[model samples]
Target chain A: MNVLNPHLKFQSQSVAKPYFVFALMLFVGQIIFGLIMGLQYVVGDFLFPLIPFNVARMVHTNLLIVWLLFGFMGAAYYLIPEEADRELHSPKLALILFWVFAAAGVLTILGYLLVPYAGLAAMTGNELLPTMGREFLEQPTITKVGIVVVALGFLYNIGMTMLKGRKTAISMVMMTGLIGLAVFFLFSFYNPENLARDKYYWWWVVHLWVEGVWELIMGSMLAFVLIKITGVDREVIEKWLYVIIAMALITGIIGTGHHFFWIGAPGVWLWLGSIFSALEPLPFFAMVLFAFNMVNRRRRQHPNRAAALWAMGTTVTAFLGAGVWGFLHTLAPVNYYTHGSQLTAAHGHLAFYGAYAMIVMTMISYAMPRLRALGEAPDARAQTIEVWGFWLMTISMLLITLFLTAAGVVQVWLQRIPEDGAALSFMLTMDQLRVFFWLRLFAGVGFAIGLVCYLVSFMQRGRVPAAVEAPAAVA
Target chain B: MSETFTKGMARNIYFGGGVFFFLVFLALTYHTETTFAARTNEAEMTEAVTRGKLVWEQNNCIGCHTLLGEGAYFAPELGNVFHRRGGEEAFKPFLHAWMKAQPLGVPGRRSMPQFNLSEQEVDDLAAFLSWTAKIDTNDWPPNKEG
Candidate 1:
């Protein structure tokens, strides 16, 4: 806590409030586009020229990335100050960067919607550098440059704060993760003429970010929240954080080979990818244990039960989604059939939701109350609604993954597994899987409703009477 | 045992192990890059194929279709499409017609937008696809329908 500014622990943390608000707004936008894509999967021509499947998917995935970035930045803004034991280096710069990032994100998404992709590419002068049209990295080259500038400014702000103040393990891990994120993103600009080489390094951005550094980010955030909510010692939690992220990077760095198995890379990847990526799940499994063990060993009750639930949920689902489901087809042999299939989509949905989405939500749930000056947590009713939102969203996402997995199984059987003479065309196989698509759409609607509950929880008032509420029981 | 497990040792493992594995990753990337000329059939990647790739990116074809089993799975895989539609001779003509067909207008079935490309552009795209088909992909897709 800053001595001069005693209204809150640190007045600088107030900036995180707007970042959370903007992130939630973008999250809603992402979900809306996701629902549109879900409908298009079944109806095909539902929004054909108006909101093409490609455009909808681009918006969905890009918005997801942007919002999570916002969440990460917000988490950094809030946690960095406390860990450093000082006021932020520059709160104004943080706000300036927020508006810049939000503007860039909105304008780029509008470009995807309003102009034809080719026209947009030309308008943005992509021919000058030509880093457009790749999946996930679909932003125009200029926007990519804007992102790099924003990231540099952000890293400088956080780094300065840490330099002038204390350097805890949690803060150090987070700073490293943030730096790695910016470095890996440079690979998005490297579009070699050789498609094989292009894909080979593209995963340097995607795989290394998600499976590698992002785990560092996730682990630190989880550790911070556990320390706060569980009344656990920082040393104990910090050691576990180091161990979990150590496993994450050790396996995840080599795990990049998993994607190289069929991308015209060397055949050595077949053995290396399988062996290394098979170990990728170990860190996620360790995370589940670390989370539960800390909670079970909790010394005091935290009022923010919803935030704690989210922390626990993130680990379990990440293991199931990133660890288990990813392992299902990660082997070179199984991936030979399942690569690019709906199974990939299945794993992608749950992994992103379970690992990234839930972790961000955990931070928001934990921080929003304190940011608003609402004591330790929100009102009891609000917390209850948030808990419901957790179950609804988590269960719906699980259902969505299962439905897609079923679709992938059928797709592989009818299309990939059959003898060449008996194999069905891609469209024919898709036609056979309409039922699963419909089920996924229904599950998506459930997720949207869950999001609604979550948003509505923010509006509820009236705290639990302190005397009437008992402290949470220790395991 | 718990007391002996210090953050110092854990931090060392995180940093030291991270650097070690990242070095291994770099070595593997070096090896992969070295093998690209032979595995990707670099000799066959003509000037027209280069232009065709530009056309493909400019159109955002990857937004919907998969190449080398990557990208959106909405449309059929195009990495092997040159071989699937009728390779070498007939693929060029088939692609030209396919580009001109515009949206299919089949109501419920998936639609491919018309790019209204010139005959030469379509031919270039065909050349690119044909070249892509030659890349050594460890015998992927299991069948020709990709």
Candidate 2:
């Protein structure tokens, strides 16, 4: 049945729908994981038996990566064919790959949830199995391999389509991003025993992939999709792409310095990390430029109102929340005070969800009307709900991040004096900071509600009528 | 030919501007190659300095102690070892002799592990340390302890 079904098709439309489901599932999973982690921070004993912090953290990070990939894959399926002006190459291979991917993703999630890092041998009555304790999360050998396989499968189908179909600069940029994803990820499989050196190499995998290359892919995808939907000039979109990529490189490389401050690295790292991290906001600011400029331009107004504004919303919010706040504490000099604090959480929550998550949602919402042809346009009031949700969740998060940032500064300057043992002082500071932690809990609840609104808005079709707003004016 | 030429031209101009700024950033980065106070790879070596270097290398001194900007930062900076040892003549013997003198093992205190060094190599290593201390680092390390 799976083989014979047309839904098993490899074409762009076939790929898009499944990828959308994959994205939403992973996104909701990430939010849940995030809330779990936040709760663990506030009350360590909250979910002790059910989900350990390590397990929850692993789930959180893994879900973030998975959902972003799903969104990218969907975008690739949709955009590549449209640019190529040809149908997707092989429906059968696509479906086969899809099932394989889905199966692998499930297995990996189960592994994370169930597999104990060490003492598996101790637990089961066998000494034969090696207790590679750190390997469970830090080494990440099996998960890394799974990710590599998925990348290859995704790249191969997309590559074949691009190879046979007419190609453009946008597709080329996206392909470059995918290739970066592949190359950088292979480095993950390498497990260095030296913890210090291993950290540097891991950053090569983690930092470079996100801030460096993935940014390229994301910028290209967002710009290309916007141009198509907005009917804007290709040159304007392409120009926006170059600016984004440039800003990404500038901040990405130096931004790595922020991670270096506490890790027993060279002292110069303090300077390097501070300077570049301070400038990290440039790309995000450029993101603002990218969003507002597009909206300001006169173009063929796409009839779908909610989805269109969300598309622009992602850029602005990412700029304010992620880019600005990311720059705020990424400086090693600044991070000397802020590292590992709740302020870091503040930066991450908005930046990632605002920038990447919004883009993914925007893409999914845009595709919904087209794919189902419900054009849910006249009734598609979900857009307003989603947009308002974006503001509510994001502003609450801003309050949380700022409160924590202030707490972090106080902790660093006041509590951690080398003359007196700082550990106890740090303890006292945390006691003082409990109020902000409570605020974070409050914000998390608000954010969760906002996310629920997002999911419900997308899901509430055929149940409640979607009074799709008439295509609103862009300005 | 009446196709939207103005918008097309504007996009081209925008793309060109973006490329121009990107190149400017790349060019600006060329000036950022500043290294630390002490030379990590020193070539100018005398007999005493070389043997002292052999001692530093043999012990893998970088495993714990940082010299100038290189090595681990767990212990205090040794870039100003000569001054810290109280001048070259005073410092050379101190490096050779400090090892034989071990700190009483206080339970919580972080102490250096003692490696038994022969009298001659200790002096050589001390001399090398003194020589390195004499080199001007141009007021680097900002403060003494870095």
Candidate 3:
């Protein structure tokens, strides 16, 4: 019998069902808002006195963060118990925290939309301990507090479950990642009055979350999925997880220095940021190697081809998007030209999509078939549709990155690199890049189409669930 | 494969290395906090500048604009806007006038919404930005036209 087979039928894993539901639903919202923002990029006053660009952009980014959190939480709820070989410590608490987090998230988005930001700030009592304005850290202090409370409760539930049962490497790494996520979030509360000082600490929350702790979470998740899909030896995959995460930390911790280079932090960051961030790609490279190697060395083949594809795609695209694209502008001299340009935007869009978005989809694709149909994988029809969705979204995002990168190169040439006459004004440069923005908007639509197909796959189940395929000899 | 790495060793590194690097981050943050006073010349943070900072925050200016290359890149970098538009004397008037201009309504061009800021709010915002321009950001933007 499969190791994962025993827990598949457990009621405790049912907690993950709702979590995945919310994650996918919010993912739809995120993509919709992303498209709106993409349109606003070209149309300028598309919403005018209504949604506006900033509000739409905020919703887009914040929704990405929230939905990914939901995905992570859901993944933990499902995998932790399975890996621990125990029932959840408290399913009721998991359900309650999910509701609380969802409600808080909904209210926060409404606050961003309904009220003017200034009024929202005033209403939220931002003055008492003002932490309202910063980018990505824009949630009111109360909302931030709610997040902390929810996170602690989540950690408690998962921690207790782990303690009661087995302590596997995957579970351990995941717990460490989750704990670090909660811990690093505390830095969001440290908003100093001085701008320079404010920026200095703000990155502790943003940079550390993505590059530092989240990598561990992502690595463990990938490892778990790889083991299940490829039937690779857990020991081999676990060691790879350790090595990958170690490199991720080794590079990623000091990689926070890159954000410090232009923020008036310190001069040494110029060198530190350049050298270390350049190496930030190492773990991602290793991931590509690890994933392909594991799949190639598989003792048996699992029928979840879509999941396996996603897993393989995650490693490769992450290596390219987060690793190579990031390295392109990481050095100080190169960053000086492309620091805040669309070059960064290009890297960010692809990196976040390739790393977080794709992996979550991988987990969802692998687990959803079982949860929904009580089958090992989605019916072949649904699997085909899901694969189509994958290629559409992945290819479109690549095009989007390429267009933005082209725009950024032109932007750097015309604006930053001074010419015979004075450099082009900001508006003039934006005007010049109109074509790229239009191309990006087109790609954005393609991404939306892909998202719809993905959603539709859930509806494409067969009349009867297929029998779970036994592991097939590969060699 | 040789049993070169153990689960126990991995766990140790996750915890131990995490703490060690966290300490390093704290040390860097401490250094940044202590040294920023000189870099930003915080002595210039007058009451108006403080109010201006509040005004900037309240309006979510960072949503569109980058200050010190830290916020959104939709708008130009405002960290050096004061110096770019010819110093505080010109910057204050320009910023105030700019705020009132709203939705520039120019076809196919990006527009700034009319925040309808009060005169004092405009002054405060301008003051805040003026102070922001003085920060030693290692001569960023590579030019004055930001």
Provide TM-scores for the models.
Answer: 0.97, 0.71, 0.95
Q: Which pairs of residues collide in model 3? A: B52-B124
For residues B1-96, what per-residue lDDT tens digits would candidate 1 score against the true structure?
Answer: 188878899999999999999999888888888999999999989989888888888888988899999999899999999888988889998998
Better of 1 and 3 by TM-score: 1
Segments of candidate 2 deviating more than 4 angstroms: A1-11, A119-140, A376-378, A422-426, A462-475, B1-146
Q: What TM value does model 1 have?
A: 0.97
Task: Point to the candidate with the largest DockQ.
Answer: 1
- Per-residue lDDT value at A467 in model 1: 28
Predicted structure with the largest lDDT when compared to the true one: 1
lDDT tens readout by residue for model 2, A1-475: 2333232223345567777787778778877877876665556445653565555665676678777878888777877777777877665666666667667666666665776533222343222321122211232344455667778877888888889988776787788778887887776654333223334445556766767777777787778667856777877677667656766776676566566554434565667667876777787788777767786783977766766677777787778776777877776555544455446656766777777777877777676645544543424465677666767766766776776676666555554324343333333455666676677778878878887877776665423233323334332
True contacts kept of 1: 0.79
Q: For candidate 1 chain A, which ten residues in a row score worst on lDDT? A: A459-468
> For residues A1-475, what per-residue lDDT tens digits would candidate 3 score against the true structure?
1235332755687788788889888889998988887887888778776887778878888999999999999999988998999989999999999999999999999999999988899999998888878899889889999999999999999999999999999999899999999998998888777888888778878888889889989998999999998888898899889888988887889889999887777788898888889999999999999999999998887888989999999988899899999999999998887888889899999999999998888888888776664478877778888999999999999999999999999999998889425799777898899899999999999998998888887666533452323322331
Instruction: Show pairs that collide, candidate 1.
Output: none
By summed lDDT, the worst window of 10 consecutive residues in model 3 chain A runs over A466-475
Order by lDDT, highest first:
1, 3, 2
Task: State which candidate, 2 or 3, has the greater lDDT.
Answer: 3
Q: Per-residue error at A443 for model 2, in Å?
A: 1.3
